[model samples]
Target: MPYQKLTAKELLALGNAAPEVNDSSWCVTWDPSEEGSAAERLVLDTLPPVLDFHTSGSTGPSRCWRRTRETAWLEAGMLAEFVGAGTPHAPGAVVAFAPPLHVYGALATFLVPARLGVPVWYRKEYVGALPETGQRRALVVATPWIFSLLLRHLDWVRSFEHLTVLYSSAMLPSDAGTLLEQAGPGRVTLVELLGSTETGGIAVRRWEGGESPVWTLFPDVTRVDGDAPGDEGAVPLVIRSPRLGHRPGEPQPAEWHTGDLVEPLDDRTFRLVGRIGRLVKVNGRRVNLDETEHRLRARLHCADLALVPVSDPMIGEHVDFYVVPALDTRADELDLSPVLALLGARPRRVHVVPAISRSALGKLRPQQTP
Candidate 1:
């Protein structure tokens, strides 16, 4: 069967007009709280009850999951309310650069408007000059990479007037956040949503002027017990949320242990510290880069170092240890022969650099081989 794409205006029209009686492979059962939209009512009356979404696989292998229409409706409603849609202060329309196939884009472009009656627009991909819409405000759904590119190309001050950006998939670089704030001041705001395909939106954080880094849990999501200390003072967090999706016939687990390590800031907020597991599988052997880095630092008595894992087709993931020698010690005087022999061919590459760029929060920025 051919794919049927629905636009925001057309979806609204479907809600207002008579829906076709023909049965679809898909069906919808809208949430009870979703109101004021003819299309939303039509979804409750007619549509597929379930849909399958594929994970982006940024952290690991991608998997397919099924979600009920009600879950989608509820999540969309929550997100719309969070972004202040449907009110006088709401954005003129939603503009998503991500493809709707991904969960993040689906929620931003499809589900959110389905609940709040917001008009929507889309881009083919995260590239090219953004078309100027005369609207005073726009809700932009994008990722960190796109933001970086936008910062390079666009006129920051004039372009971002009254714009709200939802950034996810990866952490936003601190410099980009700072530049955005400087460019637009109060007119532009960046919201970082911590979520995944399996769990939906769990928490959100924003860049405040000189505030500490922390993420606030969504009202429905709660932290579970059994969090234990992992390597390097990293404490893993478990979560229980209604938005969590489960496979068919599998009993819902008490909680999902998200591999993320976080430090509690208060009853409701937390700062992400690191990951519980940094072990990468390489050629039937496990390589713990964190441990290796620790050992290297202990032996070398140097603190300015980072071990970045880059994916390889043959080895799964290999380490690239970046070192910044002490001011007195020349890079030529440094020796890693012992470290290499201990690892037994774990790292595929190593480099000595003058300095390493880090985010404002003191986290290493993502690096690519130069």
Candidate 2:
């Protein structure tokens, strides 16, 4: 049946959904959400109700994400309230620059719009002008990178009755948010999200004249100083959210040690500091690149291996491991299950090269800031 023929409740009733649905055979491509999209197709599958998704594995390997239908409704409602579209009867629309393939994109755009029973746009339509929302506000779902490109065209800012751009991935330069909110004072609302595929929607901050340093967390999410030995002011973020997403081999309602360190102001809010130690936050989990490299070195018996954290617009940071094997591993039938497990620590991409060749003077060519 076409997704438009089904209701939200009926769709969720379809249990055991697939992990990822990218087949063009599905319906709804860049069409309005009220008309439904491929999301409906995924639910129609006769599989057991296992809702699975994945992070955009741009830098590293993509990780499997497990979510439930109940959590989907909960998060969509949370996001709708965040952007001032709480009332399902209210007039509002969602415009998405990102696709449902990632967690952030799916929740903010697909699920939220479906919950609101509102018209929506996604995929290719993002390149076009804002949807005509009439008296209703339009919520835009995008990333830090897409914001830069969209800013180049402010022709549509004042076009909507009201516009709210929901951003995730990473915080941008403060001036970026300022520029957006200032486009139309109360007429425009810019909300930046501090969450991941693992933690779902943990916190949100609305940018006014400039982006604020503090973030307001969701009701179910709690932030605390990490228990690990660390400074009082700077420590890993100990997050306990009921709606937290699946982690391999971990149960729900468990505390997630967000690799991020933050100075606590209260239980629901905090000032975000950077990641802890050599660990960089990727999809809400901290990956210890240094330690991962050490393990690879020990197991592979190769001295020319290093892991570098690469920044991504979608998944924050991913690790790319550069390895100079004594012999080509692929050709030698090397068992790489151990490294595969280590790569699971974060999103990863593996590079097996001939050598870690350095300049004649031992000068590094270019280093990426983690």
Candidate 3:
């Protein structure tokens, strides 16, 4: 059956029932009302033993990628091995609260359980509720936004004593991790994933307990550059893995240049700095937006901050800092003196917005350069 032919309720049902289906069963869900006839025909005509997912356009335009059954199985096996090795725990039932469209959420929450033959339950709505009894060794996969929502509803979050793993991804702010660890009593293993749609899911890290951010690359993936690619201080990450899927007009490179900057700690571990495009030249000096934003965030009491570029006559572009201040805080009252002092340069402008606009997955919305 074509995916476009199904309704939203049907799609949700399919996802909910996917965990119960046997390995031989190929399950898929689509909203026919929104997709129209072409999408329906494609789903009906294609017998995809593999699963394909649309990338979250968190940073830029979204793209679709396919995950073959074999590759998916491999990914599951690798994750199980890694998780078990790092934290002595056996595989168990998984509860996914994130949308299936996101690769990290889908793979970690849904496909992993399916490949492992573990019973899984999915909640399409982010109500911050935990599953009741009868679900054993449950792994909860969600984003920081959902986590924050759950925190607000403490009664719902406290229901899960069986939670062995708490996996968060997309946009996991440092403070959020700290709060979740405190709330969970540090019993639940909090894992943050790092990877994209093109590379599938690559690595996982423990974001709480003051643990250093180190990502263990998937067994199938290998770092192409001796270190990662970028400036001497920073390295650009390149991936050579079988899990990556090809788009229609994508160049067949031996490895995919991720265009993400990183700091390589060792052969197996690295810390992601930011995207290469986030680097901007200011006064003939290169400034990494990620670093500047980090500094600004650390100094200022703001919910979120972004350093974007604005057109300049003398310089090609000048940096403008946008911030979403904490509740009851005014932009005028903000003591940006420390931030400006640290940067050694003032922003062309600082705009205080109501909320930091983000995509569905909570990633910063992509901005177009004027």
Candidate 4:
């Protein structure tokens, strides 16, 4: 069979024919003009043994990657293992609010469950209707922004008592773990995934409580140590995994050099320091953008803020902060000048915008003014 594309309408018709079609798939698209037509193509096309997708370019341009059948199977098995899928009285079902086109949201929502023969209940229409279901043993895959919106509706929160797992990713805030734990009364298990489109899903953590988040390598993955942490102040992570993406017959690097900075706690667990590209030199001293952003968020009266690089003649490039003030809050109370001083540099500029522009998944849209 050769690969072919079908429109969403044709896909929907196929879906209507047998809503329980195990091998059928749909591609999520936000564009209204091509909605139904696009989905139909994906469904009718010859299914690839390996599915390929890209990540949202909130931080940068999206990168493309391929997922082999083995990779998908391994991911499904790991998810089942983590969530206790086969346990009696806790049969698992998947509900996803993230679009199926992107790696983080859609892959797990559709591929993992479909490959595992688990029933997936997808609502392409009203994503907010997720918690409104009556399913007892349910696993929800959503982004931080969707989770935050769901949290605002207490009625919806109460409806999730039977939920066993709540998974989130793509631009998750550090504090989100703690927030989820408090909101769910520990009945629901919150897992934060760390990975990109290029890397697939690499690590998982509880994301809340005082427990240190650690990376649990997939079954086929191995790590290589670069430099000791706190020495050069950046520890690079190297990966050798069978699950990595590559074209057939092409020689792939045995170890993938990830620009991610990590701190290893023992052999199995590690803490993410930041991305190598995210660090900037300020007056010859290195500044961690993650740390600076954390500090600025603490000082701001706004709901969120992001630090972005702006061209500077003196330093070649300098950081600027953008803030999204909370609704009904006065801007005068949110002074970021002191925060910049604390970060060891006077920011080139500060902009107060109506709201921070974020993707549907809560990733801060880099390069956007606000």
Candidate 5:
């Protein structure tokens, strides 16, 4: 369905007119408003404190998560306060290129504007281009892929005189960040948010050329070292955030152990190493999936690729490559010798596909091999 975009003033008017809900399912609709009809507001305001959000499952299995509405609103309020500071007095519209149903988009794009009383717009599909919001300022809520797409059409991006882009779901490569700043002579600011379905906005870092590749934790969130062993003897990162949710019957955890291994630069900043889950034994040696992918990326011409591990009785686990080749290139014809040399072992196999499957955020999804 085509997403509906409306100004904040228009949405507020609709909500003021009639916010009534009669549906027992708690889902309400607004036929003609981005904020939804009064009925939708009623549902939102009256529903239980709990909200169900599903993970993108980019790394593994997709799981349904339940979080308190309070947590969501708190994050929204924080986003508004943070983004509002740099916005013009008129308040620029929030432009999101992500699915509103997703957690990141829901909080940052939708709820943030709602908190700020600002107009917001959502792009329902990948258009590979951004509309020119003349004169007025804009806060772009998008994923890495959207920014990657924007890089291709930097000329169009210059149209926006003032813009701040929020990138999430995956890490924005340093090179990509460079291209963004170089793109469009106009003013552009990049804010990278690091979090997941389990943890709300944990930390954020503003990307500038030559700055340390470390993330600064949000004031409300704190991190501590953990004993959990991760890939390459890395330690898991433990976090305590008010925005995190707790399951029923379980005591509130003092700290949440993020399976991600990080290098602590100090009390407030850290560098993400990789996910421990990606660690696998190949030829009886530990191999980090992220490291392998990085090595392969340096050697390959493809822009999008994923390295998945498959069980092997002999080697314990064997790597498989799934890649999306450039238009003029053939994925099958690509040499595997470099990849083999990187792993110091041969992959179980390599598959050339039309494109690497991923969520809107450029996070690789688990592929089903034929």
Candidate 6:
């Protein structure tokens, strides 16, 4: 059936405030007004909070995480306040190297900028391609690796008056973050976000002179130690945040158990220690699944691959590589020997497939072997 048995009220709940039959399919009609783009505003407003963003697969295997629009907006507000971006009078713009589809990228690039009514520029090559910020507040969205790489071109933007460099995807390397040169003509603050796709914004750390050890929670978020610390004396953090990505009409837990291991601190703060749950022993040695996968990705220059830890009673565990070889590259032609040699472990077997399926955020999706 082209149309479901639903009333106009039901259609309204489904985002059609005014449902009309153009010919065969139902279409939403909006009242024409100059207050805003009525159609765009209505669409964005009526959207249900339920959405699936994929985890970064850093601490564990990749999975599709259901995030909410409410969470996004809440975090955007928090970010706005943190970056001192409420005033629309200031000339401002956003420049990003991160993909907007990911949670971090979406917040830093689109959501925050859109709220502040500032222009956004996405550059595939950001080394020397930043637009000049003439007395305007500018936010630079980047990953740790890219931020480190961008250090070489610091002098390129010496004229920027106000710049905030926000980076995610792991902590910035100590050497790269040890000092912030004062050559630039502005307060070059550095901000780092610590959170997961499942739980929106957890805590944030900001440093201006140099890297700071203190990580502060958002004004509304709170965290506590889990019931008990798990392996390696790693403490699990339980948090309550108004910015968590949650679905409506579902029974919700009063507090959320974040999978990342953290050190116990006061209510409004905590230090991220490490990741647990996904660590496995291979060849009687500890191996991090995320680290192994990332190392191999950089080594092979391939993004579509995963490492699966299979159990063997005697050997503890072993890795199996599932990869989607690059175009025109044969399965047997790819090499993992040189990389594995440094790791002191090897995959029991490698699976060559036609594709490495991923979600919008580059999280790995399940693949079947032919």
lDDT of 1 by residue, 1-97 (tens): 2223454444433432123211111122233344456656665555467656666544455567666777777787778776767565466656665
Q: Indicate whether candidate 2 or candidate 4 has the larger lDDT.
A: 2
Off by over 4 Å in 1: 1-6, 9-37, 45-47, 86-89, 156-160, 231-234, 278-318, 321-370
Candidate 3: residue pairs that collide: 4-32, 229-236, 230-236
After superposition, the stretches of candidate 4 with alpha carbons farther than 4 Å from their true spots are 1-46, 87-91, 115-118, 123-131, 160-168, 227-233, 247-252, 281-287, 291-299, 315-317, 327-333, 341-344, 354-360
Cα RMSD for predicted model 2 = 12.9
Residue 37, candidate 2: Cα error in Å is 20
Worst 10 residues of 4 by lDDT: 26-35
The residue pairs in collision within model 6 are none
Best by lDDT: 5
Error of 5 at 282 (Å): 5.3
Candidate 2 lDDT over 210-317, as tens digits, reads 536587788888776567744445667878887777855656647788767677777777777654545666666556554565456557744365666677776667
Residue 293 C-alpha lDDT in model 1? 61
**Model 1 whole-model lDDT (C-alpha atoms):** 0.62
Could you tell me which 10 consecutive residues in candidate 5 have the lowest summed lDDT?
20-29
What is the alpha-carbon lDDT of model 2 when measured against the actual structure?
A: 0.59
What are the RMSD figures for all models against the true structure?
A: 10.5, 12.9, 8.1, 8.0, 6.2, 9.2
Q: Which stretches of model 2 miss by more than 4 angstroms? A: 1-48, 58-60, 86-91, 125-136, 173-175, 211-213, 229-232, 247-250, 277-370
Q: What is the lDDT of residue 330 in candidate 2?
A: 56
User: Quick one: how many clashes does candidate 4 have?
Assistant: 16
TM-score of 1: 0.66
Off by over 4 Å in 5: 1-48, 81-91, 173-175, 184-186, 229-233, 247-253, 280-288, 291-299, 341-345
What's each prediction's TM-score?
A: 0.66, 0.61, 0.72, 0.74, 0.77, 0.61
For candidate 4, give the lDDT of residue 127: 29
On TM-score, the candidate that comes out on top is 5
